[model samples]
Target: MKKKILYWGILSAAVLVVIAASYATWNRLDPNYTCARCHEISTACAKWEQSVHADVTCTDCHGTALESFNSMSEKLNMVYKHFTTKKTFEDIHLTEKQSLALANRCAECHQAEQASWMSGAHSTTYKDIFMDVEHNKMERPYWDCFRCHGMFYDGDIDDLMAMEGGPEDWHIKDASQMDKPAITCLACHQVHHEQPRGMNYKDMDETSRGALAQKAKYPSTALYMRADKRHMPADKLLKEQIFAGDSLVAEIKDANTLLCMQCHAPGTNHQLGSEDDKTTIGDFKDMSCITCHDPHSNQLKTSHRNVHKKLFSTLSK
Candidate 1:
């Protein structure tokens, strides 16, 4: 009995020591250091070290998952990969839960902007797009819809919906995601963007600058490319000639228009005014989409929202 007790005690001590060491290491390990094992993360960390958000703690924006001891898939994934794979990895994608959690944190710093975004059409939830009765009946839901509506959604439409229920059934697999917005702050803006900060247009009086408050966003505008699982900066989007049959509709030369067109793509042949492309025509041809549409909300500017527009319309009346 004494011998057996001694052996059990020895085993227990070893286990305790291992647990203590692991907990300590986890607390002490810098996220940047652990992520350095992957080349892509290392490269991004190098940029972040010098970027404007350098002072901000990674966990603050990225969410507690980075430092969590919880049984989240990410923690398990990192550990499993460490043992099995070679040091380098090409892709390090965030799971939907982790991504959503990270996006929720942006509101902490950008309260007003976040509020405006929540009120915008771009902030549509999964239920708003996927489970719609009229639209689903008109067109069967498919993977392609994720390109615009749920760009940040980690899976295809089939994954989110119960296909077993047939074309008529639109049963969502996870009801919890019903309230979560498809397009998040991370959808349009890359936090680690290295560009100089946008002007503080909010502080400027409406008359001081020929613009309304919060009209200008920092140059962080980017589109999340589903194919690459990376954000392609707006300016880098290829300039293509839009056509209405043989008629040249428009040649996209600027980044702003190009950004919108990437997702609000033209028809298969790049035809204008087709496949959700609401290209303003006639008198509105010269006006930019942002001229009438509020950039964040993607809703039309209120009648009184723009002073110049209101004045011009009043004069015309």
Candidate 2:
């Protein structure tokens, strides 16, 4: 009995020691700090530090399963790869799966925005875009479709589709991924974008109020450009010209509306109403797209059935 007790005690002590070692190691290699250790990611860390999400930890967004055995194992694997491999950090980017996972995390804070986006056409799924019978019947799905639709998809159009450029008798290679979102929160917004400083709000005049309102309205509203695979500020992007029937009708001046144009505009063909294009013409030539359509909800006030009735009623008076 005495010998058995001694063995049990020894085993218990060993287990405790192992647990303590692991806890200590995990704390020392905290995901937030561990990410900063890489020289290549230092710039990203610096930008994050200046953004609104400076308080948020790297693990909060990047972690797969927090405080779980799998999470710890993943961290360990990353650490091991960092030390053993020379190309561990080369072209490091969040995968489509990772981006989708991170969208849920973003919803925790921006519930209203998430709900609005999810309710709108922008939150369309892979199946909705790729497997639409009517759309496929009219136009065959191609690699160029992914430039706007499935920008974050890991594989090329060839990898996803078994047959291309044909009579629409096709299916996605990964049927399991059909329901997954083709575009997510990260598709349009840059979470780590920092707001500009040095605004003179001292005067409190009408001009000052206007400037402040404009600044507050568009605090770090950035559009993710698929071509560059990077977030570009809306103001810088809106400077580009938009056409309507061979004429440069809309030189997008409003930064807020520019974000919408990124996806809504014409494709490489540059033709109006081509490939999901919604270029404005006629009387709506100079108007911003967001003038009648709510950006998040996509509700068109002018096009509503009752809009004409309301206008006629007002005019009759």
Candidate 3:
């Protein structure tokens, strides 16, 4: 009887694994098709389709498979179950904290972007700003991947479904505006199977271009972003436009200014070249914000000072 019971338990566990895997697979497939239909304004999605990541599917970076979804409790309950069930951290089945893993995975397709991200802050030792405690309190903390990847949709479903494309569209002058939740892996990197036909767009020009050219030896995939901090109540400005509310990791910006603000904000302690000395105004203006922060993990810490240093420097600058 005990052997029979053990066999039945093994069968049950196998079934659950299949169910979970199937659920995740389906969830990952559905969003790309749904998002592509609505985001017609920019050719970005069209470009994404050509990228190597086109085959990866969304769930590869984002988490997956709840019987019920888009509920706050989905994430909360999973987190609770992991803690109470006596599973070791390694035994914990999670799709989060896999940025490095995702980078490694993306390397299978997008070698260039993988190379770029690895050389940058995302793969570095400092805790991800999104996961860290120090930097997340600023005005627009929850904008990008910092909130959505591990955690399911905790905000209004209506708002999420309404949006048409990822935050990447926010910077383009002609990009469309729709209420789209974060959807695809290609949303960030232009993954290409064959080498892209032409020269990729870059910011380097004659005068300041020299340093950027030198830095390009390291080759970074991050984009340039800046918040037009010349606006009103700094906190309120961030809340309405970027953050969902109090949670900094929940930073959401459908606007590029918020993206830019991730680095450009007053009192931002970024240095032009030196680690010890922070950048001055002339130096700050010359450098673009995208040089450091990952758009997805905007709230996640990549640099040493955390968001506080970025925020403080924004004010001071």
Candidate 4:
């Protein structure tokens, strides 16, 4: 009786392992054909087939099955919904945490930029910003914080924390997001910026793609406006005037500068040097934000005041 039970158990275990392996293999081999049955997926797949990333596999960027634990949760959730409801994922947009998990994936192509951004202030993780004793004590956590930090975060500040009063009372609700940076590539860049490509688009080498990118006229740089629930293009963004007391300091025209001011905007009183505003005054009037604050790594120029003062002196000549 014991021998019979042991043999059956071993056989069952082997069968389960074989089944799991088969399922994983089938998922990775050719999911596009199955996915293409859906209209939106089909349209996206068709465009991707012609894009520069045609050679890239669907699962490479968007993780599915057992590829990544971070992505598996969401993927499995969506799959469960599809199986149970016979429904499609209507909202394809990923939340802030999910998107950040894919940030390193972007490094496969943009290594240099990724390294720079990782070293910058923008790389600050959720724990560093939200659970801060100093910051939270001063202002208290609020929805407004998401405007700049966790722009793509699906929930409000309260959803992330259980705050009673001080830092000691604060406990982050979702510990998984503690290590994830609130901002990511999607915070600034819009993928799929182009469609209907030139001939042999898939055959174009990296150098060719790099050359095209330099001259690319596409409006890809964007900012997430919580109200819009989407990243608004730089051109479409309204250019606001920065004021200093009674005088107007600067009116944003350049797309890059426009995006910067969207977050580093003037205070409620419409005054520069307030809130997060770093609007340069006096001799630096004509200069753009990117002139010093490199987007990849927003490292301030040496002794910011001295650097700009010298720059101003040079400009005068």
Top model by lDDT, which number? 4
The best candidate in terms of TM-score: 2
Check candidate 1 and list the clashing pairs: none
TM-scores, all models, native as reference: 0.72, 0.73, 0.28, 0.70
- lDDT of the candidates, in the order given: 0.66, 0.67, 0.37, 0.68
User: Residues 1-317, candidate 1, lDDT per residue (tens digit)?
Assistant: 99999999999999999987885565456756665555646867765665546656665675444355663566676778767866543466656676677777877766666777878888889888888877887888888887777776777787888756545577678999788888887677666655432333334453533343222333446777766777776667787676767888677655556677777777878766567565544445534556666667777657625543443354335
The regions of model 4 sitting more than 4 angstroms off are 1-37, 41-57, 64-90, 174-176, 195-220, 281-283, 301-317
Write one digit per residue (lDDT tens) for candidate 4, span 40-76: 4565676567555566677677766676675667767
10 residues in a row with least lDDT, candidate 4: 210-219
RMSD of each: 6.1, 6.6, 17.2, 5.5
Clashing pairs in 4: none
Model 1: per-residue Cα lDDT at residue 18: 95
Ranking by TM-score: 2, 1, 4, 3
Better of 3 and 4 by TM-score: 4
Give me the displacement of residue 107 in model 1, in angstroms.
Answer: 1.4
Summarize candidate 2's per-residue lDDT along 150-219 as a digit string, tens digits.
8878888778876645546677888888888888877766766764334322324645543443452454
Q: Where's the lowest-lDDT run of ten residues in candidate 2?
A: 195-204
Alpha carbon lDDT of residue 35, candidate 2? Answer: 62
Clashes of each: 0, 0, 41, 0
